[model samples]
Target chain A: MARKQGSHSDITGPRVRDAALRLIARHGYAAVSMRQIASEVGIQAGALYNYTPDKQTLLFDLMRGHMADLLAALEAADLQGDSLSRLEGFTRFHIRFHLPRPDQVFVSYMELRNLSDENFAAVEAMRRTYEDALESILRAGEAEGVFAVPDPRITTMALIAMLTGISNWYRAGGRLESDKIEAIYWDMVRRAVTA
Target chain B: MARKQGSHSDITGPRVRDAALRLIARHGYAAVSMRQIASEVGIQAGALYNYTPDKQTLLFDLMRGHMADLLAALEAADLQGDSLSRLEGFTRFHIRFHLPRPDQVFVSYMELRNLSDENFAAVEAMRRTYEDALESILRAGEAEGVFAVPDPRITTMALIAMLTGISNWYRAGGRLESDKIEAIYWDMVRRAVTA
Candidate 1:
């Protein structure tokens, strides 16, 4: 790691990915082309090939990165209590992680269509893994007699949509800060599923 | 009475819209060109201008038609009872009405970026009107002390997302029928919001 650190190759990869993320977020996954992305990064269109083989790979990379970031945030949060605290932590972490990067969130959700079938399966698997984590929390709450949801699947979808919808509508230049928006979303998700 | 006949104009407006909807649904709005839609409709590219002045207009026309259909479905449903019945009726109607037109549903959710400002504003207004109707139901339920919601606006987004998510994944040839899917969704929405 020490030998290769801070070399020209090291910086190019992240720069290319950042430019691709912004373009894909703004223009949608399908609409952005390699030429557009390379231009944004101050490189020739052919240079992008060095970092990622194709546009689909770039989108897959960004979304995969976001999902891992999300799960990491949840893990880092110190929730040391009952199921409710876990639920609260999950909701807050989700909204907070997603809201700041609307482009990433939009790309992650909207660009799934452009991924190759194999790439898509991998991305969706990671996403489903996160969802299962949330489901387990709900199931544990139910077993502990703290949650009384009729169906965990529906509750989970509803809660996620409630949180993700905030990202669709949340704007940094707008009135509400990200924390307030997260709190508002958390309130709705908690009430919708809480016993 | 003498003029009670169909408009057999060579450029059938509805037919063109249907073709564009399917094309845009398969390829995104930006990928779709007016010539492609005209070709799909079995007409010369130049002739398409008679129906829609431009591609954006065509996109707007399809979306407006979908919104009109949605609102009409909502209005025609029996809302004679309390807020709960009204909300249930909406969920059922939404699933039934949208399932058959998944392409339109996809276009409705995904094509807003393609519309001009005026058309986008019109679509947004129609969407808000529908949401407002749901908000009214939530308000009524809250007044009756039956629904436990922290925020009507947030709850409305969740309910819509939960129901709309069905179209994203539902297949026409699946084991479940549209009615059953609607019923399952109604069950989910009913339990999630109502006490």
Candidate 2:
């Protein structure tokens, strides 16, 4: 009986998160209810408590999960070569990583205001770590004389915003393929920072 | 009686819009309700119908007003000088214009999915026109051999994304002043496309 219950949780947990993400992405976190999320997941509303304590916790978990996933993926990318090559690698990886997860990207930015202050600070710390990765690359580039960034911190924010903004308009079968888009962006990014 | 009614509307109209923008920006359009907006405006819920037919229309009107205002302001900006200088003018204008209206900027992007099909198309057309203004500058620069933009349209999107992103983190008394921020961004923009 215990094994069966554990197996049920394994399937239900992911389904709960998936439903919550879709609902919250379509409607704001404040508008979506646990009942609706449970309905979407084909579970009883009471059963949701088994997976999450409350809506805020669920929101925090989704956001925390996204940031953790981002950091993990970036670490696994194992960026190599000089700063120039690493910058290119980072640029392409950002586009590729974010393009497939539009809902996560949308919710991550849009629902940030809904997070509790402590949750916000926690999420922000993770985000800063990600930004610092790129800043380190820029600092290295500046030292190597391959780049001439005036302000690495501001430049990091600008470049991330530029790259993430792609999720707003990009479609799979659109006018330009993702590779083409990546190449164009990489060229612009390269030119923007290079001496 | 007619004069009194007109005067009342003149006051109420803006209050309603201001309330809607704040609520919708904070909670998102889908999450916000007509009753809440009416409360925010210090009016009866039923009276909201007298001003706008429905929540969707209210959302549409706010979005339309924002775009219209943006276009009119751009037109009145009357940017002069060469393409490079005009680009500088645009960069500064965009940052300054959007910084104070973070709510409008937030709603404009976040609530696009909530807009009706026709409303979405209408907003997109206005947005395209704005993009065209920047594209024209890039084209002129390329034609004059001053810029090396391989794709003017993509470059226009990238530049706008980078500029508008200032709204995300900018504050009134932050570390850097707006003017300093503008100059730094302008330098990056100039380097990005110059030959």
Q: Give the number of the best model, judged by DockQ.
A: 2
- Report how closely model 1 matches the true complex, as a DockQ value: 0.38
* lDDT score at residue A160, model 2, on the 0-100 scale: 91
What DockQ does every candidate get? 0.38, 0.75
- Candidate 1 per-residue lDDT, tens place, B27-67, comes to 78877788889899898999888888898888888899889
A64 in model 1: Cα distance from truth in Å?
Answer: 2.2
Model 1 segments beyond 4 Å from truth? A78-80, A173-177, B1-11, B148-150, B173-184, B191-195
Where is model 2 more than 4 Å wrong at Cα? Answer: A1-6, B1-6
Give residue A145's error in model 2 in angstroms: 2.3
Q: Retained native contacts per candidate, as fractions?
A: 0.18, 0.63
- Model 2 lDDT vs. the true structure? 0.93
lDDT of 2 by residue, A6-54 (tens): 5978889888989999999998899899999999998899999999999
